[model samples]
Target: MNPPTSTWWTWLAVAALGTFHGINPAMGWLFAVALGLYRHSRRVVLLSLIPIALGHALAAGSMLIAGLSLGLVIDHSWLNRICGTLLLSWAAWHALRGHRMRPRVGMQTGFVGLAIWSFAMAASHGAGLMLIPALMPICSALPGAGGAAGAAGPTALIAAIALCVHSAAMLLTTGVISLAVFDRFGVSGLRTKWLNFDLLWTGTLAACGLVQLAL
Candidate 1:
């Protein structure tokens, strides 16, 4: 059966944001490509994605948990305001200093190091915070989401499903981009055909904040 229009849109937004994050080089694909090139092995590129996705999932899951916990205490309207303000603030910071803030990991780094870098990158980029808007409705649908009562199980189950869907989308997109770059264009492709995703991401953060506030 088809989902309701609202639910459909929410899922779509989740997937769309994941895709957007995937496109951003800081999210992992570019690093994966670099590692593969440095090691002179396509297999290395494929292997890197696993830890990258795992790290991203960890960051995103933590944010969902935090948002849910806050929802239990804060009024919906105030939560919106707070999240919106955070989004805007993050946007401003990302625009002005995000490039300089990237964690430096050497080419010889191990899987665990790569995973840690991925987690830090995702967190710094506010990748998880972006999901709060989509998450609100799902949590809100529960009767006692504003309380700690019966809402915990259902909210957790739904949040996990949502996080899985989002992470899968991000991993798929990141893998495709990583493989394409590794096999065909190589790192030189970045210099020749780089898209300024930082600017786009900053605008998106601002838009998310405005939308949340407007909601």
Candidate 2:
């Protein structure tokens, strides 16, 4: 067995995708921060990232499984349009109702609730879907990636490493940003600002989806 080749370009691609995903306002990191704020503990904030990372892993893993098992087929244009349209509809509904989806933080539920919420959010947004496809080629090129020989060791190792790196980057970036916002503005201030911007962000996502759909 040979050591799997590591490529800088692959790492960079993963980082880029993670960064891009981290900036999305609807991602669970924002809610993680809210969780931390609700508890008035930085410790809770840091701990909250665990569930977020797990959620990301779950999403990415699911995509990989689909691709490997059934050959995941995605029409990027169609998916984008569908996603965008859904976002837009959700936004419009919220706007009309003068309501925004807010993270629920309660003592009884605590960390468990946070984890479940993060998982659902990440899954719904297709957070890890893009990364898996982007990394698949590189992952498949590894020596053990093909056939039974590769399955037990090097190929699986490389895939796991890649997934870990990508997930870590996303979680770190999001966690830092969310924590910074909480520190600077405090919970109430952060909530107000996010709510105010939610409509705009939601609209933008919707428009992007629509454009993709149209294409």
User: Which candidate ranks first by lDDT, i.e. highest?
Assistant: 1
Residues 1-215, candidate 2: write the lDDT tens digits. Answer: 54344656767876766765666656666676666766788887788778777766777666545443321234333444444455456546546642334455554456667667666666555454455444555545655444544453554555567677777788878888878877776656655565544555446445544543454
- RMSD (Cα, Å) of model 2: 6.1
lDDT of 1 by residue, 34-127 (tens): 9999999999999999999999999988987787778777788899899899999999999999888989999999999999999999998888
Worst lDDT run of 10 residues, candidate 1, spans 1-10
Error of 2 at 197 (Å): 9.4
| TM-score, per-candidate, Cα-based | 0.94, 0.64
Local error of candidate 1 at 207, Å? 0.7
Model 1, C-alpha of 149: deviation from truth (Å):
1.0
